[model samples]
Target chain A: MLSNLLVQLINGIALGSTYALIALGYTMVYGIILLINFAHGEIFMAGAFVGLMLVTVFKVHIIFAFLGAMLFCMIMGVIIEKIAYKPLRRSTRLAALISAIGVSIFLSNLANLVFGAKPTTFPPTEEILFKIQTYELIAGAQITNLQILTIVTSAVLMVCLQYFIKKSRIGKAMRATSQDYDTAALMGVNVNRIISYTFAIGSSLAAAGGVLVGIYFGVVKYNMGFMVGLKAFTAAVLGGIGSIPGAMFGGLLLGIGEMLAVALGLSSYRDAIAFGILILVLLIKPTGLFGTQIQKKV
Target chain B: MLVVENVDVNYGAIRALVDVSLEVHEGEIVALIGANGAGKSTTLRSISGLVKPNKGRILFEGSELQKCPPHKVVEMGISQVPEGRRVFPLMTVLENLEMGAFTRKDRANIKDDIDKVFAKFPRLEERKKQPAGTLSGGEQQMLAIGRALMSKPKIMLMDEPSMGLAPMLVQEIFNIVKEINQSGTTILLVEQNARMALAVANRGYVLETGQVVISGAAADLAKNEAVQKAYLGV
Candidate 1:
């Protein structure tokens, strides 16, 4: 039981990384503009499709495929921001939310039409995991290469994002805009430019999450992003919607909690387990762990 | 010096500011006093580049500011403390101050300016690490003013600083506004509190229904029968 728990812990961390990356996209977009960017999941799916096509159809290297996928996803994010978000900005939040839902549905259906409804697999990798140990803390348990790669990739990405948001000039602009868009603009920050940059960064994160999931799970499909995206968003709200670090913390907790629930013999209720946590968190800490409660001036 | 001539602002089809004109000379506190929806806020918004006027030119120090973006206005040394004390609630008081200086490139001057802000608002210094939202209403107002001071603006535009404060806090805020002006920063203040606005201001204008209804020296406007009835409640 102890070894199984430890193994699940490792698995949870690996899964959490992808959630963290995708949640960063969700949180960053929400932070900058207070928009949910519901189509963000479809952006992740599109990125995976881009990677799959690049690797399988063009026979590109995995590295190039990742870059290509990120670039395409970034462009798609910018296009969505310009067309879907910008116009509805001054409108009610409900109007924008509905539009976001419309965009999400449109992209999902669009991807289905373009990529077809078939599940696709990445071409065989020379190495999927590096097995480090066969010695079990309990009988018949081991850590594999795939898990390590997943953990390392996600950790690297999170650290890079931390550096990017904390140290870079554009990162400062994002933080400023997120604090107050009108005030940020008053500081000579271009609101539109910063917003587009935000979308670009977010989409790239989603793209990375897409690729990592593909390698870890050994399957890629147009609909795969839907469930993960929802989970990532759950993690985002769990940590706090407008906070960067909150997303990371929230993702890991949600992933671990989900795994533990499954391990404890509630396997049939995994999805319910995730949503139940969300409801509990919202009821208890509506502003999230790190999120501040904001009050509008009368 | 700044000049606003025949400016008109529209919110959808509703005109918020119609044919509004005003002038601000160097080293003076000019107050705009009016009731709600009298376009006092809109005129300041137009000057600060938050709202682009449909007509007329806003000239700041000889440059036409009719089409300049909001941030560029800050770069040009005009900063506005917006209506209702819209401080970044989640940001630490220090971070809020840093945001004020976001356009400033002179790191040395910025440090000194932060010291200057802390000096002016001692309460903010004690709560510098606290988030702006946690501050009392008076403290938040002080922080808002302190944040704008970090921008090192030649002219500051303030909207309704005393709107929701205790009477004593309002007096304290007005005193700080006077001190800010005396320190050589020109001010364009918008207030519904006419008595206080006129007390600290050298000149004053009264706006009504998106136009300037009255303009005069602060003392005269304060004593004007119409101003007395509408804003001063005299």
Candidate 2:
């Protein structure tokens, strides 16, 4: 029983890292533009499908497949922003949000038309990257190579993102844009470009999450983005919508909570419990666990 | 160095500025003074490319400014210390200063300029790692002015730099403004504090209800009967 719990903990973290990857996109885009890109989940789905095609059809290396998916999703994200959201930027927030939902619907249906509704599976791990092997962690607990890969990928990407936002010029501009759009413009930040960058980074990260999820679960579907998207959005809100570290923390916490729920024999109501936490967070700690704003006393 | 000729600006159905005209010469502190809702900020906004003029033109260094975006305007060496000291509040003081220089192309000189800013306002250096929002109103104002300076702008636009500050802080801000001008930066100052503005400005424009009702040397405007009564609290 103790080993089982440890195994669940590892699985939870692996799953949580994927959610964190996608959650970062939601939080960053929302932080900069105040528009929840509801279409983001579709981007994740597209990334998975793209990765599948790259591996099975193009017969490419797995690393290249992942990179290609991320690149494709980056361009797709920028185009979607330019076409769907940029026009409505000055309009009411609801208008932009509706546009996002419309984009989400349109993309999902397009994927459905192309890929069919049936779930597709990734090539077996040995056929692409490596042979599956498990290493014992504790008395009865064991960790798989794939789980280690997922956690490491997530950790590296998140660390890189944090460092970029703190040290790089464009990343700093992105932070400034999130803080104050007009003030950023006043400081000579091309806010339109920054918005495009936000979408690009968010979408790429989501795409990375998608590819990882596809490999880990060994399956991909046209509508797979729907449930995961909602979960990632929940994670973003749980972490505090505009805070980056909050999204990471929130995703891990949610992942652990969901795994524990499943371990307790509540698999059927997993989504219900996930969303229930979202409701609880909204009702109780609306500012979230890591509110970034430090207000000045005037 | 900057010219606004018969500019008109409207917000929906409301006429914010009607046939407004003003100019600022190189190396001079030009103050645009008026009462609240008198379109002082609108004129500055129009010049800074934040708002487009409905009619007329704005020329800076013989280049038309009606079409440039705010960042493009900054690229041409005009920076505004915007109203209310609108620093990027969550960013560290050093980061805020870096943002001010975002449009400059001389990447290598940015560090030197940052050091220059630190020299001008060493208090900012003391709080370089602190978030701008945590600073006192006076320090924030200094950060704002210091931030604008980081861009190496030829002319600086200052809007209500004394707002929400104590009297002593206001005096200090004005002194800093004067020093900035004396050190070869042209200033177009917008202030409701007519007395302080006139004291620092070489020339002044009195904007009343979207029109420039008076324009002359600062000393003359300060001595004018209507200006003394309406704005200067004589």
Candidate 3:
């Protein structure tokens, strides 16, 4: 029984890593502009479809396909920002938010039209990369190589992101802009370019998450982003909207919690459990577990 | 080095500045002093390109500045130490200083400028790793000024550098202002502390309701009976 639970826990972590990848995008964008890119889920879907096309049409290797998807989504994210969000930036937050939803609808429908409404099967990882291999653990528990890859890849990307934000020149500019937009501009940081970079990075990370999810689940759907995007957003808010580490922690927790519910014979209500935790966390700690209270200066 | 000519600014329906005009020449400390609603800050904001003027033009080193964006204005060799300091609260003192040189590419000079700033404000050097928010009000003000210095600006526009400080700290800030000016950067100062501003300034402009009501040498303005009664609280 303990080993069975442990296996479920490992599975939960693998799922959580993907969610965390998407959640980072949400949190970073929100931190900079305070606008929720509701269409981010659509960007994820776009990545999966792009990945599929790269593999099937171009016959690219799996690793290159994954990277190609990320690069494509980065451009897509920047284009969406320019077309939909940029003009409404000076208007009102509600206006920008409505625009985000509109873009989200437009992109998903565009994907549906291009990729069709049917669920497409991802190329088998065993055929493209290494064969599906498992390692036996204590108490006869098993861990797949794919699972290990997903977790490790997520960790490496996250660590790289953390280092970039903490140590790089542009990263310092991002932190300053997030803190105070006007002051950053006064310091000669091109606020517009920084905003564009934020969207680019966020979207690419979401794309990476999309490709990983497609590979793990072995099925890619036109509307796959909607549910996963919402869950990732929930994880972001649960971890504290603007805090980087908070989003990571929140995603892992949400993933594990959902899997545990399923393990406990509540699989049918997994979505309900995930959302219930969001509502509970909001009620108990609205600032989120790691969110700091914003102090308004006089 | 900087010129504002008959500029008018408005916020929605309200007129914030009416035909405001001011100037600061090379190697001079020019102070704009007035009451709370006298449009003092508006004049500085206009010069810094934070606000658009409906009429007239701003010339910085012989180039039009009226349409320039804030970042471009900074690139034009002007840096503003904004009112209330506006330090990035979460960033360390060193990081905040680094951000000041965002537009520059000279890495070695940037390091030298940082050292110069640290030499000027030793307290910041001591707490370089601590977040700016953790600094006391005086230290934060020093950080703000030090950060501005990192830009190696041709002219520095300081808005209310002495606001919300103890009398002793205010005096110390005024001394730093004089020291900075003597170090060859032209200064355009906006302050509510009329007496202190006039004391440090080479020339003074008294703004009332967005128009320049009085302009002359700072010593002359300090001695004017009308200026003393209204602004000096004498």
* Model 2 per-residue lDDT at A277: 83
lDDT of 1 by residue, A94-170 (tens): 88888888988898888778877888886655532333433444454555666677778778888988898876667
- lDDT value, residue B58 of candidate 2: 93
**Residue A75, candidate 2: how far off, in angstroms?**
0.5
Error of 3 at A261 (Å): 1.0
Worst 10 residues of 1 chain A by lDDT: A127-136
The alpha-carbon lDDT assigned to residue B214 of candidate 1 equals: 93
- Every candidate's CA RMSD: 2.8, 1.4, 1.2
Candidate 2 residue pairs in backbone clash: none
Candidate 2 C-alpha lDDT tens digits along A120-166: 99999999999999998877888999999999999999999999999
Task: Say which docking band candidate 2 falls in.
Answer: medium
Better of 1 and 2 by TM-score: 2
Q: What stretches of model 2 exceed 4 Å from their correct place?
A: A294-298
lDDT of 3 at A139: 86
Candidate ordering by TM-score (highest first): 3, 2, 1
Q: CA lDDT, every prediction?
A: 0.86, 0.91, 0.91
Q: Which pairs clash inside model 3?
A: none
Candidate 2, A189: how far from true, in Å?
A: 1.4
Docking class of 3: medium
Quality of candidate 2 docking, DockQ? 0.63
lDDT tens per residue, model 1, B94-184:
8778888888888778878888889888888998989888888888888888888888899999999998999999999899899989989
